[model samples]
Target: MSKHFWQTVGLGTIAGFRSMTAPALLTGNLAKFHPQALAGSPLRYLQKPLVATGFKLLAGGELVGDKLPQTPNRIAPPVLLGRLLSGALVGATLYKINHGKTLNGALLGSAVAGLATFGSFWLRKKTTDESGLPSALVGGLEDILVLSSGLALSKGTDIGAPAGRAL
Candidate 1:
């Protein structure tokens, strides 16, 4: 459908790999492109400052905690739910700001995030089993991918755009 719809879906897919990072990226986007959307919300007073700060901290913590031996699987019930919810919220916000169907966006986002979660988990396990590299290194790479993708999707920039046209 619309470019905004695709962008929201892309963000949701990224969120499946890194749940906390997606919301942080969305908060940044809301501050830059849709500040008015937050005006009447409960968080209006805290606004971007608090939202961005809190999510960023959470994202960073997630990345670090992910390397810990006691860390839970991303696909575990609690973690999966968080990722799904984050994807839905970000997708709805993006669609609402772009004047699209919020419910459709949320559904698309949640579905994609769930699929991505399973896909990434399988891929990560396969890679670790085959390559013999430390899981941490592979996970770090995934973190980078998720963060970059989140930023690009949230900014609504064409990833293949010419240098001058890229965000």
Candidate 2:
């Protein structure tokens, strides 16, 4: 497999946690760099402004709503389904950028999303319990992490490198 493949997987792993934000970041990138590719699709009408504004709003809403008491678990059926779809979309887009098969990306994205749903839930619970911080504070930090990850993936940064590897 190519470095791009690993990079895609890394981004998909992040997407498994961020779900909607990752895809929204991809949508923004597509709108900026390849507007014509979106043509004839349902999202074609979004254009740059709508794509940027709308997805950001949605992402913000998700972040805020997550801090609410009534917000559903990330692994809930409907929420998980949405996360899987978002991951697949973002992964497929990343694969297409590298001239790879979309199906492989979709499968990778969906699998990562499923795994991350459980993994992040456990990690978050553990962190909150250990740190003695409010869940909201931890969720805010997660929001920052997710947003940063999404942006890095969209920009195609050196995700292929291991932690200490030079880009």
Candidate 3:
């Protein structure tokens, strides 16, 4: 309906491909470069009180629910988690930013997410593929997009003119 709407769509499409990195770039960049644009999005969750505690748990390598099996274990769980994280987070982010009212935020977040995926995929090709870094990075980025976009959209403003139309 609007130019911003189209932009959001583009972002959502990209975000579908890869979730984590897109949001990370946006969030991290905003935090460092565009503080003015920073709002109540999920990106701000990084600084929350409970989140700080959760971070410590993650940093400590502690698994939630159940302890992870050592070696000779199925890789399905981790793989599934990664994929789910990517999709769900990205979707949620889009929804959040949209403020549960529009597809605008989701679309924008998706586009951003897609860019991150493309870049990460490209980089993985150059790596030794020995480490699981690629997948992990993808997952994390997806989470960021989903959370940030969703939150941002929750209170977003429709700005600018529609596409393919004269101002």
Return the top candidate by lDDT: 1
Ranking the candidates on lDDT from highest down gives 1, 2, 3
Query: Would you list the C-alpha lDDT of every candidate in the order shown?
Result: 0.73, 0.68, 0.39
The CA-based lDDT of model 3 is what?
Answer: 0.39
Winner on lDDT between 1 and 2 is 1
Report each candidate's C-alpha RMSD, comma-separated, in the order given.
4.9, 5.5, 10.4
Clashing pairs in 1: none
C-alpha TM-score for every candidate: 0.84, 0.79, 0.30
In candidate 1, which residue ranges exceed 4 Å CA deviation? 35-47, 155-167
Q: Please tell me which model should have the higher TM-score, number 2 or number 3.
A: 2
Prediction 1 global C-alpha lDDT: 0.73
Better of 2 and 3 by lDDT: 2
lDDT of 2: 0.68
Sorting all predicted structures by TM-score, with the top scorer first, yields 1, 2, 3
Residue 26, candidate 3: C-alpha displacement in angstroms = 4.0
Cα distance off (Å), candidate 3, residue 83:
2.7
**How do the residues 80-122 of candidate 2 rate in per-residue lDDT, one tens digit apiece?**
8877877677666555555567688778877887788788888
Worst 10 residues of 3 by lDDT: 65-74
lDDT of 3 by residue, 1-167 (tens): 54445444444443443333333323332233222222455544533445445533542342221123341111235533443344344344434433443343544444444554455445543442655455445445544554566446422433212223322
